[model samples]
Target chain A: MALRLTGYDEVMAQDLIQSTWITAVRRLESFEWKSTLKTWLIGILINVNREQIHKEQKKKETEQVREDTMISKSGTVSGYDIEQGLIQLPIGYRRVIILHDIEGYQHKEIGAILGIEEGTSKSQLFQARKALRNWLTDNSNEE
Target chain B: MKSKMNHEELTPEERAAFDELSNFKLPPASLEARVINELKNQGLIEKQKTMNIYLKWTASVAASVLIFFAGSYWGKQSIENSDIDPNLAYMLILHEDESFRPGDPMAMFEEYGNWMQDIIDRGIKITGHELDNEAVMVKASSETHFGEEATERTSGYFIVEAESREEALEIARKNPHVKYGGTIELKPYVVR
Candidate 1:
């Protein structure tokens, strides 16, 4: 997921994941088990990915909105399919959709992960779904 | 991590799409192993990265305690020695000395290719395309502009990653150009 989120830059994702592991290893004692460990780890991954996206955006702006991520490394999300459509979503919307829809994270969890309001996360997911539907229609017309 | 965690049902099309995406492939086995191995090798929590925020407070206190000793100065140098800076990108600027030629043409080029292959294997090189010797230059200025200026000539260039000008020089010197009459110029590749 970290690789997918980072436009399929595996090395970058691996670096981020390694940092996440270091963080997790250090804070293992503090974990109260309120959420499943997987959920916690996913949260860490999401934060790392978000930081990377922020850095890339700061460096390259819109130029970093990589179509190759979906077009190239996307597996089942191949071609002009809905998965392609999802990956094409703006980073914010894409994150929201992936977390809430695909990864079963609630808006509240997403808000924490993304450092956004829960309401913002909810609305982003709504907008993301709408965009995906629109993209599907546009792609079909192009076909 | 287990990825299938659907709770809210979406519209049929949305549901299908999301389900399809849930089967997203994991990163390669080697990447996973590298991460795990690095974490273990670093001793993750047991090493420099302390898990406790409270320890950070103590670290600040410890930092103050070191100011009285000369060891505080050594600490900065220690960090510089510890890790390679991965941020900066370096460029090997190929200065095409138009008249320069090695005695053995094939041997020089083969040596150049071998050096480049080593750099490529290290993954430092981004990409490069060497231009043909055929030259053309365009000039524009406040005065009358001239076409096909003679002074401008560059053979080719390669971009690589290095922390400092010295390091860039170290990488650039390996270019077979240095041994022959051709010149290798090192420059920091600035991302605009």
Candidate 2:
């Protein structure tokens, strides 16, 4: 609808028509065929978009790491940290304690399997673990 | 997962910023439907990949046709009215005699304007530029030049369009400079 006229009648609705034509023409002209004999230009643009997406993915991965390592006391420990911490624990001690306390097993199995009183087996193990934890912290402070 | 922001433990800057936030307030209920309708009317905005090549091609062809006809019309008009030929040139060489002074433009100014305008109107003269009268001649190792003392330099020149050598001379004869005891040197100007 945009007509490019060399000359026009000034007496008509010239200003209005000319302004409308200019606006429409400009918008239409924006859809230019930017093709070239060298196809590498378009290839580079695609590569740039790909690089941007890769960068965004890397950023998201970093955000995930931050989420896992965030310092909080609201019982949000990462599984990786738990695995590493459990490795430092004595094999039988933590195994028995985890089965009884963490896994909510009966003390009869703690006694039969690990040789201790059925009722006292749970509480005694709990107290011993608390004492060990305090001793570790104290030792750390001394160091 | 990391915990969301706990406002109770906010830093002073964060707490102050949070305190300034307004309570939930709804927009005017009527505006929501209007916005939805507007969105529906426009639909999705998208970029076009290609232009209508057929339309542009047609326009180009039409432009070529218009140019051809328009050029022929003007070409014919100039040939009939002005007797212009590409190979021809009109040279008007100015000559002043003993009675002519260099600085009396008032006597010839009006007549020169009308004279030059007539040539332009007839489409005979495309353009002309006036030159300063300074001529140099090398005599042995020294050079003799036109200055205040050496006043024998040709005055000025004009180029006009003509059909033949005789017609060019006729143009030179009618020049305003010739009326005041001045002669014109007509010559053929070959343009490469």
Candidate 3:
């Protein structure tokens, strides 16, 4: 999950998981069991990933532009292509699509995890799916 | 060109593609080690023992002397009396720290195989398995802690047949783990 969220960057994904574990252990007493442990850990991971992105905002912007170009040239729609398409998605769209479609989390749960409004989660999912579909269909037409 | 489809529902191909992403991928094993190390550094997990080398040497020598005398007395008694059960089971709990010399993994396996074969050749039944790094400590307070809780982790264990407690200690002393600077605690299983 962290891997997909971090656009398959292994080093960043590993760092996120490590940070999440440390944070979870530190704040274990505060965990009221409102959600499952896995859900709680993922919430920490999302926050950690967001913090890291803020820290590396300039580098990420450059990488995102490069990834967008690669996605445009990528031909055909397959599982691997879909994953590439996800990597090229805007961070917010990627998070919503991954949480909703890939992880099967509902708008309510997604809102809780991402700290967004339930309606915002629903709208983001619609926009994310639409964007992903357009990218996939465009690639398919090219092939 | 795009197909007319509801933006809320993913196309079947897109759903199938998303399904592929849902399959869990295992993180690198080294990442677990790194996390545990960082936890230890932060004082969240117990650190390994930092005993003086001389103190460790002294303790090792004292334990050897005690084992030698106990083994001699028991060996003499067992030979004199045939009533002693010759096949008592004892569990050898192997504890390993940073001092443990697990050189090449293949060589370590070969060494273990030879050790087990030696016991089998002596007509002793033996079984054991090496433990993984992951551990969860569940407490009475309904709290669970993950990772190592102590300095030395239980690397593995072996249950072998011996004549008595002293004989079990002697067998444990000869284990490859002892030669590799690891500790083995001999425990007799209670028969009900």
Select the stronger candidate by TM-score from 1 and 2: 1
Candidate 2 per-residue lDDT, tens place, B1-192, comes to 112333123235422332222111222333323432442354311111232322232122221121112111111111123333547866677766576543223224334545654554565743332334556878889997775344455755556678778767766776666776667788777778
User: Which CAPRI quality tier does the interface of model 1 achieve?
Assistant: incorrect
- Compared with the true structure, all predictions reach lDDT values of 0.53, 0.37, 0.61
What fraction of the true Cα-Cα contacts (under 8 Å, chains A to B) does candidate 3 also have?
0.39
lDDT of 1 at A19: 69
Candidate 1: list runs displaced more than 4 Å. A56-80, A141-143, B1-9, B45-192
- Per-residue lDDT of A1-143 in model 1, one digit per residue for the tens? 66546545667766766666566555555554455344555676666666766775632212333434323232223323655665567766777777777666778878876878999887777777776655554444331
What shift in Å separates residue A80 of candidate 3 from its native position after superposition? Answer: 0.7
Instruction: For each candidate in turn, give its C-alpha RMSD to the true structure in angstroms.
Output: 22.8, 38.2, 17.2
The TM-score of candidate 2 is 0.30
Better of 2 and 3 by DockQ: 3
If you assessed candidate 2 against the hidden native complex, which CAPRI class would it receive? incorrect
The TM-scores, one per candidate, come to 0.46, 0.30, 0.53
lDDT of 3 by residue, B18-135 (tens): 6665445656647756875786687543421221211223222222221112111111111112222334778888887778764433233335545654665576655443454445
Model 2 C-alpha lDDT versus the unseen true structure: 0.37
Order the candidates by TM-score, highest first.
3, 1, 2
Winning model by DockQ: 3
Model 3 chain A: worst 10 consecutive residues (lDDT sum): A58-67
